[model samples]
Target: MFRFDWKMTLFVLLLLPVLIRLGYWQLEREAEKRDLQQLYEERQSSAPLPISGVDWSDKDIGWSRIQAEGYYETEYNFLLDNRIQSGQVGYEVLTPFRTDYGVLLINRGWIAAGPRREILPSIETPEDKAVIEATIYIPDGELMMFGEETLSGEQWPKRIQQVHLARMSEALGEKLIPARLRLSAGSAGELSIDWQTVNMQPEVHRGYAIQWFLMAAALVVLFVFFSFRRKEKPNE
Candidate 1:
């Protein structure tokens, strides 16, 4: 018969559930990542469509190739801070492009920050009209303070930590299209293009899940080996 040490059993009981739970959690994450990659792949394979042709009701329009013709609001620009590219700290230049349909925030590209925090880089935006080919990125709704903004106060090429649609709208004195367009290569005003669609692959999550499950299995094996006892012969 097998005998279990109370303390060891209790330890296994406590730690096993945590290990199993972590494995399941990683599996769930893997599933979610797979779904996102599938969606991204489906959208990327299609042809570019006019920005105005898309239906607003479709919420999963990310990576949707799009084209738009408009003049950039060169006077007002935004610098998205803490954007890193090629292991160098920089900012993503977000310029307002006024289209006939609506005003859209165009992610031009990454620009290196200067030696000092206060000294901002100079971005020369052509005042002339431009037709840009880009991808539409509809970000998820964020929980924000009722009236708070992430902008760097009243300043040209304002630095922002986050993309708050309502805050940007308030700053621009008008409502924006709620979507940030990433300019394609060779397009007007486009700079360094280093976009990472999926930061972590599903395989990574799957590997983590396997590790957690293996830990749980090892714990079970050790518990079983320690708790087992050989039958003893009867004594006279």
Candidate 2:
């Protein structure tokens, strides 16, 4: 015998769509992650290309290995906060490089945070022009902004929460390149550079998708079991 519960049915209907949508969204994300991984692998295997005359609008430029000759703009530097390395909290140093092509931001590397928040670690910048090899890194999306604190002051060695290329370019009065150069291994830089190829592996997204679908399936089974089970008759 079937007993229909309107409220329960309505709840199930509402939740089912949401669960299905989430699973599908995860699948879409998995596909995107796979495509990104493939592109990254292809770029990594290719030879290092010169930065000069490269089309900035090209979508694939983000992962490309590049070489450039430029002088560091030591005075105006940026400290990207909340970077972790070797189980220690620190900041990633970013300094501008004035190259013949254009101004490019170079992520020098990570430095440990000071003992107190008021104090900052010392960063040395090379003044001379030199050949630099690095990987192009374009930020995936907009970063969460803490507040105006990161944007305050016109001081050298400015500490920022995230790298806002447009804002920084305007502040510096120069059209900086769209992407940042992650200092390649064995490059001449003060700090350490440890970059990951991808932020999240596709397998993780696929796992999440499976979990969501399983949850949806379980919900349907539970709903059916609860609706069909007959209540025990009370003994007179």
Candidate 3:
């Protein structure tokens, strides 16, 4: 014999789809992460290209390996605040580089914030013409993250939450290449170099999917147990 409860069944019917959908969503993310990592590896193996030669209109300029022969714009510099490395809070050093092709921002890498925020680290920029090899990295929605005052300040090294190409171009009085060149390890003027293609591993996404699915299964089991009932004989 079976017992049917319309209210409980309706509630489950509405919720089951949502839980199952979430599980599938995580699985989709897992697959996408795998694809992105593969692309990164492939790009890394290729030979480096000149920064100015590549077309900037492409959607993914983040992983480009490029060479720029130029001198660091010593006067203007930016320190991206709230960067963390090895459990220590720090800042990312960003210096403007003037190349023959164009002017672009170069991320020298992370540096400790020192004992206090007010005490800025002394960056050693090369006054002479030098060449650097690096990979381009443009964060998503970088424009919205900045404000009108982000590029403003009397200080030589401005502290900012994020880089805005339009604001920076206006401040520096030069149109930049629209991405930050992350200096490669061992490159001239490089500091700590540790960049990851994907923030979360694909396996972690799959594990989350399993947890959501397990909850959905438990819901089904409870609904089934309540639906079944034992038949009793009536006494004479």
Instruction: Go through the candidates in order and give the clash count of each.
Output: 0, 0, 0
Q: Against the unseen true structure, what C-alpha lDDT does each candidate score? A: 0.84, 0.84, 0.81
99-163 per-residue lDDT for model 1 (tens digits): 89989889999999999999999997878888888888654333353665556466888988778
lDDT by residue for model 2 (1-236), tens: 67899999999999998998999998998898888778878987888898876888897687888888988998888888989999999999998988889988989889999999878888988888788888887565445776554444677777788888887887687889888779887776657877876667788889999999999999999999999998778982
- Model 3 scores worst on lDDT over the 10 consecutive residues at 138-147
Q: How well is each residue in 18-97 modelled by candidate 3, as lDDT tens digits?
A: 98999999999999889877877887789888876777777876687988898989888888888889988988888888
**Model 1 compared with the native: what TM-score?**
0.83
Model 1 stretches with alpha carbons more than 4 Å out: 5-8, 138-152, 229-236
lDDT of 2 at 205: 84
C-alpha lDDT of residue 203 in model 2: 87
Using all chains and alpha carbons, the TM-scores for the candidates as numbered come to 0.83, 0.91, 0.87
TM-score of 2: 0.91
Q: Indicate which candidate wins on TM-score.
A: 2
- By how many angstroms RMSD does model 3 differ from the true structure? 3.5
After TM-score superposition, what is the CA distance of residue 148 in candidate 3 from its true location, in Å?
Answer: 6.4
